[model samples]
Target: MNLTLSLAINGGTGTTKKRKQLLRDSIVVDDVMSCDGGDHHSRVVRLLQARERMMAKLEADDPRVAAAAPDDGSGGLRLMHLLLSSVAAAESGDAHAAAAALHEVWRRASFRGGDPAQRVAAYFADALASSRLVVRSSSSSPAAASAAPPTRAERFLAYTMFYQASPIYQLAHFTANQAIVEAFESGGRRRLHVVDFDVSYGFQWPSLIQSLSHAAAASTSRSNSHDDGDGDCAEPVSLRITGLGTSPDELRQTEARLARFASGCPNLRFQFEGIVDDGPDSGCIKVDDDATVVVNLVFPAAAQSSMTSSTREEECSALLARIRSLNPSLVFLVEKDGSGSGGNAKSRGRSSSVLPAFTASLRYFAAVFDSLHECLPADSAERLAIERNHLGTEICDAMASFADYNDNYGGGDDDHVAEPTATSWKQMMERAGLERVELSSRTVSQAKLLLKMKSGGCGGVGFRVIMEGEGGRAMSLGWRDRAQLITTTGWRSRRRSINKAFC
Candidate 1:
């Protein structure tokens, strides 16, 4: 197995690379400054700040941080109205009106408060600000050089906080694992190799290790009751994970963490290898003829963080193509939800895509922000950290289209967010000669059970899970009345036909 990870940021052209400094400097602006929010000076500062965070890979602040401020019942409706007005003003090139709207949003919105809608508005404000503050001055300060990339500790902290606060990571990992486990069980294989495309903190593997260990223990126990001493019926299972990541130190730490956790799983033999994502290309991943191979495509953060990213489809498509070459037993395609024939459109974004994509995410993240109110209290520091340090950066980057990024992308139809006529990921997977595999009953049941355990936090029934697509192979988990936020689907390589002449 071979991999590279440290998810987020631009999906570049061919491969999904780590987000890097392009986002680090852009969105991490000082929420309050001496400069007037409506002035040209303010616009420069906002643009420069957004641009800097764009390079720095930062995000908007947390709404929970501002929960102390009076909401005045203005969170949901007013924020949406302000964002719509801001979009209209920016699109119409009414600089003054846009500035006023932005100013009002800044005044009313809390980047560090507990209102999800208010936080969504803050990010959209950054988006609107980035849209207007495009012309970065050549006289930009020497101090504007990019801050050092986030340390491994910082990235790990962000990944852990989000994983603990939300069911997003758990949903992606457990569902995918179930599919892989079923594939192995049905195929009658004992060795499993999982190549995780984006394995940041290695959070997905511990549960998988435990699951496999339990099955092995149960299998061995049954065999021991019948075999006596006549045969060695040890249901030995070997599991290997090839994780792709951005840095050596983080990868080493993840390897250590996973190894330590796996050590406690007595019946499972586990091996893990962490490789840098950008080191090599096509033939780098070495496969085993004996092991059942699986590809795990869950991104590093968020429910749909990578799903709504601008370049996600092209990058993911290219990735699927590479994985097709490996001909794995199962490919778990996990992403944020979409409405369609299904199994399509892994991306919908603001910058480098279309306006509708931005609007779609604005609505989606608003719900996400609101849902947090149920999951975390207003004053919890973890809530603030998750929003500001992790999700805020992701939301801010969603709207970031650098001044020249459009020049390179050409705004092709393929970049459309969730448009009706968009090219579907289902089509992409099919074109790669991979067939969509149904999510097994066990997978769907486990998904529902997960939500049931966490339902108290987000309110019951609203976060229900349902099987989607024909025969219910696709599973979706979402908040009430809105889009299914995260969907996990399984796929397999189509078995080639035997030659008639040979037969």
Candidate 2:
């Protein structure tokens, strides 16, 4: 996976002497440069030179370099430096050098254990050949224009890979489980109806199903104990999961997976129905009066939009209103906190720009890469596969399509816009007439425990969960002291009446 060694011995562009000279010059400049009163151009040049030095240091055999692994920021800085160098090279019209730099970046990122390095290397090499250094619109290439969307296998691979390093799925699982438990305890109906929006793979629901099954079993046992030789004390709690997805194959797969997980719980009767429709507005979602409904919106399709867009805002409001109309007992919202296709736009115009999106992706994935480095060995094949197939694609796409990167990356569609911030989501939910439900201390503790267990080998990897803002309703998950994922549960509250006076 070490690109430097391979490139050095192979027929690379630079001669041995010239390469050594470049390295020496970069080191000398790095040692001598200072940031005191320089113009913008000079400052940029100095920073690039410093980045070159950092890259060299990363490749060195020094113990200090190994000691400064990603958890400490040094390794992440080197990765960022290589990325920036690639961008700078591309900007300067040196496509060959830019491609080479990007190769090195992906090589280093592929260090975590997963698949064979050759597999990852082959993908990067092919990507370099097929795509230009800059991101191009789908219309720019007839091949891209006609390209089919990612298959279910490809989607599953990408998702499982991403989950290796990120705790997002786990956080969402915990949040959803807590919401379900609360709904069962507070609501009158024993039958729970869960409406999951865009339930890709249905990974989050299995744990909730299992938990409810166990709870039902315990309740049944207690009821039997209290029975005075009577036939029955109370009906067993039943679960009905309605999965929403756009693809029939994916929906079928989700239904099958959930059914398999539900089969083991004898005390809990479970039913699964998959709906193929756009979303809540499709008239597929049904609200039953006899059951307690829980709307699980884990990374809903609509949430992946630019909240700044008036059209998108209206759509989001409409979708929320539809869910509110269901009168569900609880709604679980889980989302990435960092900017990208899964983040919030601070202002209206900036959401479409490439630089901001790229910067956001960089900061978000840096912590992600660092966490992966901490948990897995440098040579782990799983880690390599995840980095190469998942995160690497994201970084490269961002670099190529600085502006409209999300659309370009997702193959020209608004369906994959950057994620909004937690604060922005809170505002959106409040406007939709949902009241924030503070995440329980038990849920927060479980989140912390999950992080601890995952990062135990790597000494925690600087994972922290915090309750932010007044009343502590906003719960954020952070890595390396930066909040990268935020999730909170909300419930529908009766609207407060507004007082009016006659003029």
Candidate 3:
């Protein structure tokens, strides 16, 4: 069955265009340095020193280190120290030293349960091979590119590997699921449609499908109780998901994954269709009048820039306007919490310089690495692989963005742009004629609980729900109160009066 949806693009003229604003360098740089009380250079130095200390502790017969097994917390700490040392060395231009550090990391990390050990070993091997090539090349000649652009399989591997090491995906999925549940319950609509923007691997929908099934069963049970002595259950919910992506293969993969998930959910009837598109424009989205629609934007807005534009305002505004026309019951937006030059209004006019963007990226990834250090074990090959493919590559890409030979290091023409901040997204949503709906207090509590469960009883990570720009709301995930990631939710107001209040 063919199920495609579209939204009309409004072409009304005379709409006032607002002047673009850029984030101040001082504010952006200071925000990144605040957590470590120093600049990015100093922070890197400190991390290296800490790595040395950790190495010394590992060499010593410290009771904790001795008692710790390869897969334990201490082992994870050791692995993290080695990984950070390698990164520091590579960043400092000691490619051979970085190779050595990676070797040690691979040797020390455990590979007992899964193929992570093999994957991490392969990554280290590749690094060592690249280092050898760099050493063999003429000092005066530019070095050749060591690797090709990532294939689709490699990209998918990197994406999944990143999810294993960090809580960002988990946090995003949790937030989105809460929003979905709230919308599903409150609207009381028997049919629900979910539009996932840039759906990669369809990882966010399985749990949501489960929740919908449970809710459907509960509602049916209640309806049966209220019926005239009838034992029959109420009608099942009809769920249709529309996944948008640029690649037909990736979209089909997402469909397959979701189809499998739906098969397990017998409480509701499910349908899924994948759409290949560059952006959300006319004839790309369809809304059913009898169904409540929820739009899910998870880390999709950051890469919306084109070659001619660094600011995502125009793209974001157009997309939001189209979505608003559909009158979605809820819009779930999740983005990284930094001001880099790529994604939204905050990054406008600053795409030429790389230092500000690099600093922000450094600070953000540092918190992530620190969190991983606290949560995973040194012997966990999965953690090592994740760092190598995900976090490690991110740090390298940020540095390469500023280099004169950036193209040699897999840097594209658009690599210098800054990322978006939560505040910028709030403004963009408001401009698109959407108002923030305060997430329930229960949702906030659930987020806290989810973090606690993921932290492995360390209590190192925390979050706070803050209100911004009228009724707009944002939840920040941080380490020791330093914000790392922000997930925000927006809703279309049914009453015109409610919309005017935000204006």
Candidate 4:
């Protein structure tokens, strides 16, 4: 099973000249400029010129609010006028107005585009229509977007902070939640006890809740409405969640979420147990022969293990040994893909190469220079440039970094840490006395489905496996492949019950 993952780099860091060139070449050209000396040409020129003007304004950090003073109804009207004015200037052979209008459009479009090329086109199309061009949206193709939700990098200033906020960290949460749901389904358990090794922000739990609610609701509704209680009937069960974390504050936050969830469903219980900050030593949880689902949502990787005292190898081994001894319905394990940051620069330290280091602070500026050099089709470049300016540096940096990770375009080093693969995770579970069951995985991509887990190892459901406990009585289940769960939820047999549980 292949686990789709993403990476988060420190924001605003400078990309190398080499990286910039690669980014330009990587974009496939879609169309050519068909500018003429008429209204079409004028409009096109106006747009390009507006883009250039906007770029300059943004470069100067102008706060004029959408070229001069922006009014209250600026939502789409102002943008339209701005765009039309540029088009008119360009096509009318007025190079000056055309240039000014193009610049303005370019500056404002970036912010309005929302970091997707499709959105950028939509923004421009709308702007054109506002300008009385009456352009249609079906004229352009779709652009790529980041699979992972966007966030600021300033939060990751420290190594600990950086490690906690990494995209892979969220992937780990996905792995755990996936395991829990699969285990409950196979074990026929009505409840689950999830021992989260580290609960930083509880990012993965929400996804699980959404997916479980969605899948169970859809399945139950469909089955009840369509299935005639024949052999195709799928049973639904409730999930009792218990999360463990070292920070009391975080645990309290998790507890609050449980409280909110409990208001609607009485059967489903969610609890956050705060444990002492020590190495991995099962504080209150014990692996026992009961109808309970026990899991360790911790990473023992050399890279991430250092982030927590309990996540060390020996500690993890002990914890796993105990888990195996208890014989859980299943065990889900996730760690850093490989080791090391893979970037030339170490956390809170110097870079491997002096050139990148010297130019690091100017990454955004360098990107600007590169964009100028690329000289996109007069229309395209203008559109792209204007959009970039409006989005602001912070948002642009986040999007650019996401794009780099999504396409694997930047960073001096190529040695990225591989998260647990299906085979490796399966081996680990088996070695620890757990048997493999069902498996599922999906790649996160805007180009394809953002996220979907295929069933059965390589492609099954949304995770790698849904193992039943071994020993005939209650088989210990696990994923044959090492996968990071991105979503979690419980299966309910009844549609009404599911609606009550989630609604």
lDDT on C-alpha atoms for all candidate structures: 0.59, 0.55, 0.53, 0.35
Q: Write the per-residue lDDT of candidate 4 for residues 1-503, one digit (tens) a residue.
A: 01111122212212233223322422121012234446555444444444333323222331121223223222222333344343334333344543444444444444333223223323443333223222222222122122122233322222223223222243445545655666656665545555555655455565555555555556667777876667564444344454555667666766676556544543233445555445444355543234455555444322222111122334445655655444455555443222221111111121111111111212222222222222223345443433343323323333233223223322323222122112223333445555533334331121012123222212233223222223211111122222222212111111111111100
Give the worst 10-residue stretch by lDDT in candidate 3.
14-23
Every model's TM-score? 0.73, 0.69, 0.63, 0.37
Measured by lDDT, the strongest candidate is 1
Answer with 1 or 4, whichever has the higher lDDT. Answer: 1
The reply for model 1, stretches above 4 Å from the true place, is 1-75, 84-98, 127-155, 228-230, 233-235, 279-283, 300-314, 338-353, 401-404, 410-423, 496-503
In candidate 2, what are the lDDT values of residues 250-364, reduced to their tens digit?
8888788888888887778888888776544463666566788888887665655533345446667777777776777788777654334445323233232222334344445
* lDDT tens readout by residue for model 3, 64-93: 222232433224334434444554454434
Compared with the true structure, model 4 gives a TM-score of 0.37
Q: Given candidate 4, what's the lDDT at residue 8?
A: 21
- Candidate 2 residue spans exceeding 4 A from truth: 1-151, 154-158, 161-166, 279-283, 306-308, 342-352, 392-423, 496-503
Model 3, residue 454: C-alpha shift (Å): 1.1
* Local distance difference test, candidate 3: 0.53
Cα displacement (angstroms), candidate 3, residue 209, comes to 0.4
Models ranked on lDDT = 1, 2, 3, 4
For candidate 1, the TM-score is 0.73
Model 4 / residue 60 / CA error / Å: 39
